[model samples]
Target: MRTIESYLRMLLIMTLCYLIAEWVIDEPKGTVLFNPYVLGFLFFIFLLVISFEVIIGVLERIADQLTTPEQRVALEEAKKQKALENKWKKRFAEWLIGKQTTPEAQLILEDHNYDGIRELDNPLPPWWLYLFYLTLIFGVVYLGYYHLFGGSDQKQNFEQEMAMAKEQIETYKKTAASFVDETNVTVLTDASSLESGKSLFEIHCAICHQNDGGGAIGPNLTDNYWILGGDIKSIFLTIAKGGRPGKGMIAWNNSLKPQEIQQLSSFILSLNGTTPQNPKAPEGTLINQ
Candidate 1:
């Protein structure tokens, strides 16, 4: 039994429930109204709704007490309107479920019988049937487009994205800071880059190589002896990819950009034959040869 009055009350109840939930999650324990403005706004709304309901109740009570003959007739009309609304609600519910039969329609009863029971001749709802047909059509289109017609699938899209990303990276390398491996590296002779490389080395690499690339826990970088290779490309590869495990050198490629690594290689190479305080004894094949 629903009336416009009942619907408005339901909305009021729902608003109160939402406000209660808001008050709970908003503030943590021991923190007073974490956001005073928002909580205060909610409180104001609550008071407004309560005051509105009180005013409505008082007006309704006054109208009941002051009812005249015309007002009584209007009240009866309102009751008829409520009954009409209920009748429509019932009809709509039956239509939506697609399972209602009028008493006069005896022709729809089926011949199939079990004991004293008989089934009704009923078809599925038209809306449900149309929705099913739409889904089937969509399925066929999807299958043909993605598979038979060679449209891009998830794997193809992923691979295409990866290829595009790789191409963009290569283009950027050509225009900006280019990548350097052992095959393409050469000693950078400029003083500014060398100074930058020196600074980068001291900050990120000085722990094991010492403050001056003199080498303490790692090989002596100043001497002619080379643990890995001593050429520019060799030094670049060694520094970028690191030496073998237990050699105390980790890859700097992840931390430093390719151009910066190139500068680092040149700086280390420039330090060759330079004297260091108590330099570690040279350990590999002589590279100054």
Candidate 2:
């Protein structure tokens, strides 16, 4: 519990547990640590760490009570040997901070005194100075590469990003047309959308429904009567999956894009209450408007 190995082992265990949990849950969106399950797991690990520390402390106390004078001496010697083995690590850490002055060795300023508190002349930490030097180097490189070399600035970057976003939107629009099903389908009412639908209906549906949707071999569409339910969702389903069994209208889900089907459905609904030349007789149950 007092060793670096103990902390590393705990970290390894927590990482493995996190990986397993992520694999099982497989949710990639949002902040990972904010996920409820991950937060719960972290809480569990905290409890585990507390439990291990308590257990180890208790065991060490018990072992101390059981040890003889010779064994206690041996343990102290072993601890001293272990400290000597890790002495280099301590030295390395101190080197990272530069030369430091002990309290007794510190030089107190003669004039800088406030409320009896004196200032000590202390050297800056090597790590902080090194970081400052790195920043200076980075600044020079950045200035040369950007300001001097005429690299794209913020406005140019924004324009490029906007162009990329526009392209992505256009791509999504093209693909999104096909990403529809009965559950999500809706009637498209825009003139251009309806015109596209009209063209599709004439090419594919006119044979059975007639050119004007007055019904030919199929049931009357201009009337409120429908073979299946006449709601937008029901019509979408009917169009996508087809009507009843073997003798019913063939499924158009494969032949037409979902957007096209949506348009055709909208046009079909528009036909209701409209008069057509040589309209066929209604066959299905009448639905109240």
Clashes of each: 0, 0
Candidate with the greatest lDDT versus the true structure:
2
Residue-wise lDDT of candidate 1 within 1-289, one digit each (tens)?
2343555565777567556656666556435344666567657766776687777778877988899989889998998898688887656544545554567465788888899799867777655777889999999999999879999989989999999999997787677645666667778999999999899889988788877778888888888899788888788888889999877798888988878999988989888888877688888998654
Total clashes for model 1: 0
Candidate 2 Cα deviation (angstroms), residue 267: 4.0
Candidate 2 Cα outliers beyond 4 Å, as residue runs: 1-25, 54-77, 87-111, 119-162, 168-289
How well does each candidate superpose onto the true structure, as a TM-score?
A: 0.58, 0.43
Q: Report the Cα lDDT for candidate 1.
A: 0.78
Compose the digit string of candidate 2's lDDT tens values, residues 3-110. 544666678888787777767775784456678868898789878986997798799899999999999999999988987898886576566666646776585555
Tell me the spans in candidate 1 whose CA falls farther than 4 Å from its real position: 1-120, 146-152, 177-185
Error of 1 at 289 (Å): 6.0
Which has the greatest TM-score?
1
